[model samples]
Target: MEKCRASSRIVIIGAGVSGIAAATRLLQNNFHNVQILEAENRIGGRINTVYFGDNVIDLGAQWCHGKQQNCVYDMVKDMGILHETGDYYSPIKRVRSNKEVIPHELATKIHDIAVKSMPSGPHPVVGSFGTHLAQAYWRRIESELPELDRTVASESLNTFAKHESSIIGADNLFEVSVREHIEYHECDGDKLLHWGTKGYRRFLRLLMHVSEDSPEELGLLEGRVQLAKKVTKIELACPRKVILRCEDGDYFEADHVICTVSLGVLQEQHEKLFTPPLPAAKVNAIRGLTLGTVNKLYLEYGKQPLPDGWVGFFCLWLEQDLTELRKTEHSWVEGITGVHMITCQPRMLMAWVNGPHGRHMENLSDEKVLEGLQWLFRKFLTFEIPPPQRFVRSKWFSNPNFRGSWSHRPTKADERKTGPWDLESPVLGEDGHLGLLFAGEASSRNYFSTVHGALEAGYREADRLIGHYTSCSAKA
Candidate 1:
């Protein structure tokens, strides 16, 4: 390891996983002077852990996603959290159709073939996933899964494809779409899926490990992180450094600042915050690209325990044509979607809506949606669902800090324009000499949305900055 270097004061904005990870790296690299300037009072920006009585529900990210290359899983491997087993490719026992339940292992085989058809090298950067992979995969899904209702598999594939396009089905999969765009940029070709039966949202579980210790104690929990403080503006003309101003009237400054806030936040409030202003290209990217949002509608009910071999899904068609079903937008997906009922121990049924459909749900009152869910229960289960003793939803888009889930899938034209985003030079001098640096999931070319992606970006930027410093010092 390199010996301790100059104590250059660095200010890191945003306290989410990426921000924290960057701080952790600076300190670990023996960079003595590092301070994080978060706009909010809480450290975990989007990574929120809420307790509804006894449930440790995650409002932000929970999944380890692509467990094979997950930084989160590596961090928690030694933490000793009970039931934290890795079971991504769990069997698909129930289909939203009117046929016998397909065997879990066999269903996964069919799913694998579908994934194989996906375009290699960065998702979303290509054509609409709904048109390509979803349609193509659905075709294969039906032919492969024999004895399965042809229409049921088709619908499932379609819905799955929409997820690739929609905010919900993507990364941060259970809820937000921030990670989905990230995953598209990072992964080699395929991504893993964790069922989360033991605990779906693993990202929060990992963050719970970080603030567990203080610096002196050498444990991650001791670090104090405040929640709820929102930043209003930021100025980089602090003579010798950068200063951050929040609506709370608190001010902070340091040598170099890492503005790790979400692109969504930039899209919403940057114009009001930055004095000198970001370049047109930067501003346009923030505004031109839409801030996608989606919410997971969780419903709880008393177990009615359906008959044996009932095989789920009252629909004989929707589930069968899964491929085409994903294209079904807004109101259409609301009706024919999801395995809302099953005899799991937790007894919580969830349906995720994305794109315009998600916005519709977000706009409606909880009571109205709850009423609609009641009707759904009666329509599908032939019984009324228990008015959930508890209810929860993630409002990432509505939150001030996170304007929307995260960046959308990169586009084809973006490649030539934003070509080699990796080589675009870190936050540096006006002459590109290297005074400032940028690091975050958005900055990620390979590992965009995942924790690993952000971590890798931090490491890459750190290396770039360190190299420049080393070269200058050596020349002297």
Candidate 2:
């Protein structure tokens, strides 16, 4: 039985966390004939980390999110690699585009009230989170805040909306389903766990069972992953086998195939990639689920602009300023919700942008982006800031392999009546064997858009295959 399981060939598409997790679990279960085909030249898909200036910066997935019940946290919690990032709202500055500095105490109070106003559980009524939040927030503001502070509080809420949009990977909260937003299960413990200088790539090493102190190496996946193998076609109609044809003209046959491509890729390539076409339900789910863009701009300064112990700047734009900016070339600047100082790198700052504005930012030249940032800083801050010595920006929306950042449950998801379950279901071959399976963060119902969710999805598929073979062998 063990030998039979070892001989069963398996091919996994994408070398992201999900794919790597699936491969690792399979190899551990004695499935020796496993291969991972990554379209990019690198192993980690969206978990890219690069050295900038004096320290490493993650261009992709940065934090561990939560500790309790998080598989990624469980693996590295005691390794001394995880760093607890205290309250994200503390030691911060909130300034309006009109050059009005909000008091820290008042800003914190408004922020707390705004957060409390948001729905914490699934609403019995079906509606958009934006609508519900707006109504609730304004109601609280009318009763709780003084009339003089209401305008600033309203602007602050707008800033909070942008930040929430970036986190949910939505252009606006109105596009997100209120019920689905609340359905997402957040793991208990610290919500922001940083890897410090190690970067997210360290998670990959630990998955391969490689020690941090040892020489950097891909322990189990040394020769198993083929980079730059973009699979353009998948022939699943074959009697008892599954065949994958790559753009490089290389092909492979496997007893079973696990696809861990991002939701964005699936939405773009599902029709051309599959042989007999994906089920209508799966296709509908793909269309219904939204993949929104979240981009980052990294700026390295010759001199630090912010004081020590300062978290970052939250840009609250007055309605008049925002309206005027929307009429000019600097409209994309509105997408930038906040500019945060890198945790360990004192001279570096990171700006976050989301939605259509993120896509627009990708099309602009670096010089233009810098100009916009300079204009934004000047409008909001009282101090004069120097130009960045070096600049780096992420273009996840423009990348063909990844059309956008992450998935979200859209407002129309309920109407479509299709979801992650439809995507996760396997297609059976003529011989009644599982020929094609799906695994990715998007397929995780409760934990979509999370790295740990991706890992869990991978383990789920691998266990399914293991259980299938085990049952079959018992009957034999």
Candidate 3:
């Protein structure tokens, strides 16, 4: 048996924030024998950005999340990627019956009341987030509230339900929504938002800073991250070494291995992937939670700074029976309810779409996708909407590696209910020796789905491996 050396090599799967963090921490801690194995030819996982002329668009993670206690923010600052104030939640652009854009101020006021005035304390009746948020709107909106049966579906409740689904990536609207948690937890919606690259990539690079999103960028960053390394199997049976098999007929043996692949990959391809097999509990947790996608439609309107600055999401509202949208697929989509447009400088606007509705919209062909937009465009304001001079889209869900967007609030049954083991991914054998170990965002808790979450988890796993070895050496 090959004795694990203090410099025993470590292999990290995935080049996202988590994997990069783990490798960097190990190297910084004097562990030089480490290499990152990324299936995609890029790093940073979901924190991907695209360069179009002067416009810097983010196809993956666009937000920096909480600023108050956000660790990634500090890292960004450390990396000198300064951030300015943002207007993400505000200017709540909404499309109305007239096909004209509704000022965000109106919804902001209503949302404020609803959020601040939510009911408190435990309840005998346990309802889904949709039910809770709908009720919250009723209490806060008060007179502004729409008709409601209370006994059944209410207008305000249904709208809230749809809004929640659109925000969260839930399979259905009325089922359960991640938006409730965001609204319930986040006191202030205003936080750091998109600013070209805004040091977002720089910050991540400083942390994990391994590979770039695209093949070209990888060359730009130098070949620190190994690309096109499709991980076929992970063997952790021999406690001191984890062997990683690549599809390209290559192999890597590491003292510890971190599996930072998304839950989507785990859930979708777990049966054939694991060598020693993942815990039954962990497997169940992954599948129970749903993975979603967010596709963007960037429209460059011929340098025309029209009135109201491109009307900022100026599009028509769909008239589907909100209830039907809540269903997975009720025959077909009824009609456009609303359109969100953001008119910005350099002539560019993005249409933010997520959840089931976003999925339906993104799956369509480029021509069809544009047609859907034109349907809303024509219904709202008539203009010579040209076949976009530039088009941008994301294949996050379709990609086998990514499967979909980042993690969401796992289902009640899916949520991890216990200690930190779920957070401490292992790649070694059961004999207390090291074969391999894995950790990353999907392996993290509390901070999962965020860059910091991925960072902390990566560090934790590295520390675990290093600490265990340190103790064993001390005894010797």
Q: Which candidate ranks first by lDDT, i.e. highest?
A: 2
Model 2 C-alpha lDDT per residue in residues 54-134, reported as the tens digit of each score: 788888899988887898999877779899988875556888887787888888888888888887774544788899889
Residue 392: error of model 1 in Å? 1.1
How far off is residue 61 in model 3, in Å? Answer: 1.4
Candidate 3 residue runs with Cα over 4 Å from true position: 1-6, 78-80, 97-105, 117-126, 143-167, 172-190, 195-199, 208-224, 304-306, 309-311, 314-345, 382-386, 412-428, 434-436
RMSD of each: 6.2, 1.6, 4.8
TM-score of each: 0.73, 0.97, 0.82
* Candidate 1 residue lDDT tens string, 317-405: 34334345455432434533444332223555555555555556666677766765555445445433577765666666666777666
Quantify all predictions' global Cα lDDT against the true fold.
0.52, 0.88, 0.59
Which consecutive 10 residues in model 1 have the weakest lDDT in total?
171-180
lDDT of 1: 0.52
Best by TM-score: 2
Candidate 1 C-alpha error for residue 249, in Å: 3.2
